[model samples]
Target: MGNKNISMAVIRRLPKYYRYLADLLAKDIQRISSKELSEIIGFTASQIRQDLNNFGGFGQQGYGYNVEALHREIAKILGLDKKYKAILVGSGNLGQALTNYSGFKNAGFDIMAVFDANPRMIGLKIRDYEIMDSDLIESFVSENNVEIAILCIPKEGAQQVADRLVKSGIKGIWNFAPVDLDVPSSVIVESVNLTESLFTLSYLMKDGEEA
Candidate 1:
């Protein structure tokens, strides 16, 4: 199957495999069998083999997977090599925290600029980039060729801002707003609803305690 045809479950697992392989590489380990990797990441050997095989099977039959090689392959599949440009909107607590995260840049989603609707926040600097007025988002996105937008705006205004982002040619949005956004079918929006996630975690913890 082509990469585009890969299942979402397999796609989601790619980052896990990439992270574990990176750890092994950092520890100076050169190779790992599927069975060994499964033990480390809590996946079945067959599952690991099957998932990697979907992308042409990086592992050899006898020698197993080369850690660095497999990591590079997974990172390629995840588009970490592209260093996609992104912009952050709504420079509140969540937005600032996301801007402060170095992992996003390390993983190739570089936030080129930050913006806020608040006049007080517009001139503030986060890290190296100055926060600009949200009014300038369209022109900034156009000039920068930004592929993704990170939205940390309030729910009430999320849809309007998302519409503007879509109009400005952003292909993807990483939304942290409480409400869902309505965008074109061609535009992908990944919403991170922190409250819902916390509730789910609470449920899991309660179940574990009862068990």
Candidate 2:
């Protein structure tokens, strides 16, 4: 039951699985044993088996799982199986780069709306979606039924944007600002800091690596 629950925790590692699986699938690799997968993913064979056993386990007593099946199963579990509509906040460099990024749309997530208050940018288009006035967020999101929000505002504005997002009926937020947010517990917020990761990599390169 614990292993089953851990497998349910699998959502946290979907990106790793997706990346590794995509590589294997591209290589035309079909089936793989738990031990082999463990070697590939740096997990222990037992851990791999336990994690996979929850929703997908295919190894024969002696063989292993069919890689393709496991790949699709993980994709489905991560909500990547369906197209996700997203709204982006801010029209600054960081936000524009993401809107121009082809990968977000290609990877089953689409930036359907971009918002900003800057008059110069409000009518500009990025990745096919013109920037809209931030004041219209609630109406735009409600009318379009937006499910995801990508926040690219300044740190000082993080909590405020989060508050607005929660009120806008957004289900998930991918926050890019360097700040902690406070909102109703019902909303999901995912924050990523590129500067921290880059500095961490540099630190590791200068010294050794740290977990």
Candidate 3:
């Protein structure tokens, strides 16, 4: 099948591949042997060959692999080749922080638009983008070709916004609203509960940092 059907066990190895390739590329190393890669990534040489083989042939019997080529290949496999256009659905404190964060653009994501329900907040500029009312979400997404969205609205409005976003043709969602959402099989949603994460960390650190 495709990369989606790639098993989790194999998927876990992707970061290793990416990291080694990136490091080699930075050092201007044009090629790498599988044995060397295994030492760097802590995988067996056979495992490295098998992982690369599962995707496609990446090396030769005598020479080795082209480092730059492998880097480009892994990036494409992980959806980094094309920039992902996204929108922020809440335009609140957290949403505005995301808007101000310039780092996502470097990682192949661009927050092109933002939405809110309040009239006073709508049409105001935050960072480089202006906040638009959620009423125009469908048209905005269609016009801008936005494929992903980040939800930071209240828990009550979370599902409501998700429903609108599903109908708006968004392919993926990043939800921070403390609610489990229901979407189509075709759409992907990643939940990140910051409150819960901090609380969990606090409990683990209750005895004063890990020894």
Candidate 4:
């Protein structure tokens, strides 16, 4: 099946599967049955099977799945095998924390540079990268062939920055700003709203209390 035909729910679960498979590999586990994966991953065995089937079932009916091979396949499916040149558009607390995270680099997303509108933050070092002025973003992205952008700025300027990113050939955006961005259909955007997520958790807790 083509990726477009896959449900977003299945696509989101791919990362969880990849992570658990990697954990199993580290434990020196070799092969795993769908039921076995279900126990650890908290999904029903049938659900696991169906999810995997979306991208061509890799598990054998009797022999189950080879842990190493499954992990590699999931990595490729998630595009983790390819390297992405990315840039960060904010250098505030959240932005700095993201820069400090080594996981992004390990997963093939290299943050080539950081940009910020604040005058004080300009020229400041976040690890090896010195923060550049936001005005230079378009040129920098075009010149460096950046494919992804991580936006950690406030909602006020998020859309403006997104526009600049799209103009400069950014294919994907990992957005942390609370506001939704308006961009071309060809440009992919994944947004994380901390307040909204926390609010969801709060609502669930309230419902549990009322129940």
Which candidate ranks first by TM-score, i.e. highest? 4
Every candidate's lDDT: 0.93, 0.82, 0.88, 0.96
User: lDDT tens string, model 2, 74-101?
Assistant: 8876778899889999999999998889
Assess every candidate by TM-score: 0.95, 0.87, 0.79, 0.99
Write one digit per residue (lDDT tens) for candidate 1, span 1-211: 3467898999989999989998999999999999999999999999999999999999999999999999998888887878799999998989989999999988788899999999998888999989999999999898899999999999999999999999999999999999988999999888899999999999999999999
lDDT of 4 at 196: 100
Alpha carbon lDDT of residue 98, candidate 1? 94
| Local accuracy of candidate 4 as per-residue lDDT tens digits, 129-154 | 99999999999999999999999999
lDDT of 3 by residue, 68-183 (tens): 99899888877789999999988889999988888789878998889999899999999878889889988888787789999989999898888888887889999999999999
User: How much lDDT does candidate 2 score?
Assistant: 0.82
lDDT computed for candidate 4: 0.96
Error of 2 at 176 (Å): 0.4
Question: In model 3, where is the ten-residue run with the lowest total lDDT?
Answer: 202-211
Better of 3 and 4 by lDDT: 4
The better candidate by lDDT, 2 or 3, is: 3
Model 1 is weakest, by summed lDDT over 10 consecutive residues, at 1-10
Query: Which residue segments of model 4 deviate by more than 4 Å?
Result: none
